[model samples]
Target: MNATAQPLVRFRGVGKSYDGVTPVVEGLDLDIQEGEFLSLLGPSGSGKTTCLMMLAGFESPSKGEIWLGDTLLNTTPPHKRNIGMVFQNYALFPHMSVAENVAYPLTVRRVDRAAKAEAVKRALDMVRMNEFADRLPKSLSGGQQQRIALARALVFNPRLVLMDEPLGALDKRLREHMQIELKDLHRTLGLTFVYVTHDQSEALTMSDRVAVFDNGRIQQIDRVDSLYETPSNGVVANFVGDNNVFVGRLISVQDGRAEVGLPDGERIFGQMVGAARVGDTVRACVRPERMTLCTRSGFDGGTPSLNTMHARTAGTLYFGDHVRVRFAVNQQEGGFVKVPLDDESLTEWSAGDELMLKFDERHLRIFA
Candidate 1:
């Protein structure tokens, strides 16, 4: 992002409501920078897809304004907005050959024959689908079909590209392969890309920034590392990634840190996310990977500012690269600690064993 350039797209108090009563998207004020890969991420029916549709001009905003560069887009038709859209279903022409499908955008715009052919060839080559140009849509694999859709979207060289779960139909390996390709193409072409997906991993993999949406609103928007590491509230923390939440009351607060009392009467300390006085209810949020685990022999783990708990091991699930160990802290269950395969747990630990779990105060996030 540059220091002081105008945003490529802006939404100011923008809202959408089909019934003129309830809003699917309400009071959305967002900015999309030029040449950045931004992803709108959330769970189903969280207004992410509706926001994308509004920006693509498929759905109109019932209130407020949308701007592309300097022009207001309230009355602009879909084609006149000059935005390329790639959908979840690919939306390809099944009867057309690959080359013909890629050239459809050019045909609609009435580009000259020679220029349209050259553009179609370049777009197909860019997606590595030029060799399959003569094949019908059904003959290609899911990944190849996705590539053709991408080429068609890129053929006319639109101002911005919008993708709504474009890789949702492919297998896991193929989807990962396409993620890398899309990221590479974004870097090579230096064009603005706005993507929508419910997959947080995909958003983190491809986006320079992510807008996390929930209940018809944006909870937070920030860089991936910042959003994951320092979430603004409990909603953002629990939604963006794997988080273990402990309900507790504020026993005391000192210098932006809080001493919390859990249900079991144990006291622990963590960084307070916001201002809270004594005796206020709060939550302790911790990522599984941020915790440290040790056997009974190796832990004296209690201190004034550090958090330590006695947990009895229940079971372990292997994930090839990492192992997730589930345990019960006192009578409560659903606590997980992730460790690498080479950790001592593979050979030295088993179910029904007592382990001490400790974490630094910096890794524990407190929210009210």
Candidate 2:
């Protein structure tokens, strides 16, 4: 997104509380760019759903302000917000036909018959559910009903769409298929989307940017790649993907990098995150895919072993396309290296094999 682009939605110091004393969402300030897919992702009770509810006007904010374009939305009712919503249970009326369900929003707005019919047709076509216009929602399969719900949300031409785990009820394969479909639809329609989900993989797969929430606070908000590759903290690193983390004392901090000392007196270097003192006990993290497993010979004379560590193979597990080799670094089994199936040379290792784990210094991240 362009930095200069004006945000279509803004949350300034937004907070939510049901019991008056405890907050579910706290001091949130976020700007969502127009036509971008932004996901509120976190575990349950982490305040992501509350944020969505506040924006959708289903729940009022206890403090702060929410703006849609230039309009203040704190006191606006849901129907007047011009925002479409889709939920996990499909929320379809069993008595209403698909077309009728899709036309409900337009009906509430008193749209003329001809225009409502045209919009209903276009929305059905967008979701490829034109043939099911006459079918009752109860007769439709889970995926079909989800499509109809989506079409209904779009039929009225809402300014923004909010989805809260709309695919949670579907089977795994169907859910994956819908993720792709939703992303493609978002790109084609170019509409602002705010999604709330607890599944990290689902958020990563569908969102252009993700706002990670925990304990009623947004820990980090950034592009998906940045969130995964360079997470802002330990919570995000562990939540977004497979991260190998170890506790170490910060030995030195120079320029943006740091030298860390392990309990066994071995030292490694990496880029430092946040500020840290020389003696501060810090966390060092690296992704599983970034570690390279090599035998002793591979790191001898030619390789100077700048970012190398001595590790013993704890175990190796196979997962169809790739194998994960767990390593005991400094007598602690914490790090792992992922090896592709086609790499035969790296697969013939036993649990007790003495090996070396090498990685680029830039791949390591130190968190204070």
Candidate 3:
């Protein structure tokens, strides 16, 4: 996102508490750019849903302010906020036909018959559900019901939408299909979306930027690529993707890199993440896919900046696209390397075989 982009929604020093004792959302300061799909992702009870509720005016902030453009939303009611909302349960009125359900928002605002009919048709057409307009919510499949719910949310042509795990009720395949559909719909509508979900893959698949929450606060907020490639903290790193971490003591820091001394008396260089001084404890983190296996002789004259460690293969697990090779390094277990299925190394190694595991210095992230 551009630095000067105007925010469609802003949470400035916002905090929410149930009993005025513990904050469920604490001091949140975030900006959602207009027309961007931003996801609030984390595990259950992480306060992502609370943030969405606050933005939609269903819940008020305990302290500070929530703003939509230049309007203060603290005193506004949900119906007067002009924000569309989709919930996990598909929240459609079972007694109403699909068309009527989609038109309910327009009906509440007293739109004329002709205008409401036209708007309903257009919204249903956008979700490709025009053919099922007469079907009741109970008569449709789970995926179809979700489509109607989405159509209803879009029928009023609101500038912003808040979705709280809208696809959580579908099966795996249908959920995946709806993810693509939602992305396309967001693109075609060009409306700002604030989505909340616990699924990491769903967040990565559909978000322009993801804010990871834990303990009622955002751990990191960045583009999907940046969150996965360079997490700001150990919590964000472990929550976003698979990682292998090794605890060590900081030995030295120079330039943009630092040397960490492992328990086995070996030192390795990596990019520093946070404030660290000599003699401080730190963790060296690397992704399994970033490490490669090679014979000792093959690594003798390899890249000068690469780090190498001696390891013996313990076992291997086959995933369709890749193979996970577990190994023991420096008498410690839990170290593994991932090899692509097409790589010859998958068939060339056996249990108890010794090899060198090599990773580039730049790929190693040091967290203090």
Candidate 4:
């Protein structure tokens, strides 16, 4: 994120409110870099869709300015914005053929018949929908219809494309395949994309960066790896992946580590994440995969460090590639350790078995 690099789309203090009192998007300041795929990811009604609508010029901002390059887009109409849009339902014209649907954008702009045909052919080819040119919307499958919708968006050669859960209508397998295809298309065309979705995994798979929205505000914005590995807050940590939270009082803070006193007179050390002081209540969060589990006999009972925990196995869950072993520590539901499927210990574990869970201090994040 170079300070001087110009953004393709800029939202400056943007806010959107439908009822004039309750805002859907509040004070959103974001930058979509040139040729970057940025996803607005959140649960339903989290303002991600509203942000996309605002950027697409379908909905005007209640406050702040939106800029596409140097032009102010707050006053621009949707048709004049030179932006492509794809919706969850495909939004194809039922009466039109696939080719005709792809050419609809060009037709709206009064493109000549010859040039519109050429653009339609090229767009259809790009989406691998060329052979379906003669097919009507009703005759095509959901995936094929989505391809036609994408072709229509790209036919007009727009610099930016906004997609609102475009893959929502497809089955899981098709949606995954289309995610790769969409990423490839974005790379080939070098077009900026603003995608909206409630699916966290989809956002992580397709976007160069993700902005996570919650309660009409952005919770965090970062690359997928950063968001998963080092979430800025507990909300992000819990939302992005499986996190084990231990709420305790801070006993000490020194260097880059803090000590948290658990309920059962146990103090654990973890990497200091946010501002906290002695006597402050805090949460030490760790991901399931970071924890290593072993039988109690394998580990000597020594002075507790940030990395060690004693627990009893509650149960185990098989996820094909991995095993999640649930544990009960200090009377809390505590957390689970993720063991790889290849590990033979996964099958040996039983409920009520005492175990020691170990993790590196660096993997634990402390937040107030």
For residues 1-368, what per-residue lDDT tens digits would candidate 1 score against the true structure? 65279999999999888899988999999999999999999999899999999999999999989999998998999888889999999998999999999999888888999999999999999999889999999999999999999999898898899999999989999999999999999999988999999999999999999999988889999999999999988888988889877887899887877888988888778889877777888889999999878888987756666688777888889888899888787634468889998876557678899988888888999998
**Which of candidates 1 and 4 is the stronger one according to TM-score?**
1
Tens-digit lDDT track of model 3 for 22-91 = 8999989999999999999999999999999998888899998988989999999998888999999989
RMSD of each: 1.4, 1.7, 1.6, 1.8
Question: Candidate 2, residues 8-29: lDDT per residue as tens digits?
Answer: 9999999999999999999999
Q: Residue 333 error for model 2, in Å?
A: 4.3
Pairs with steric clashes in candidate 4: 269-306
CA error at residue 56 for candidate 2, angstroms: 0.5
Top TM-score model: 1
The residue pairs in collision within model 2 are: none
**Cα lDDT listed for each candidate:** 0.89, 0.90, 0.90, 0.89
Once all C-alphas are superposed, what RMSD does model 4 give against the true structure? 1.8
Q: What's the lDDT for residue 75 in model 1?
A: 94
| Count of clashes, each model | 0, 0, 0, 1
In model 3, how large is the Cα lDDT of residue 328?
79
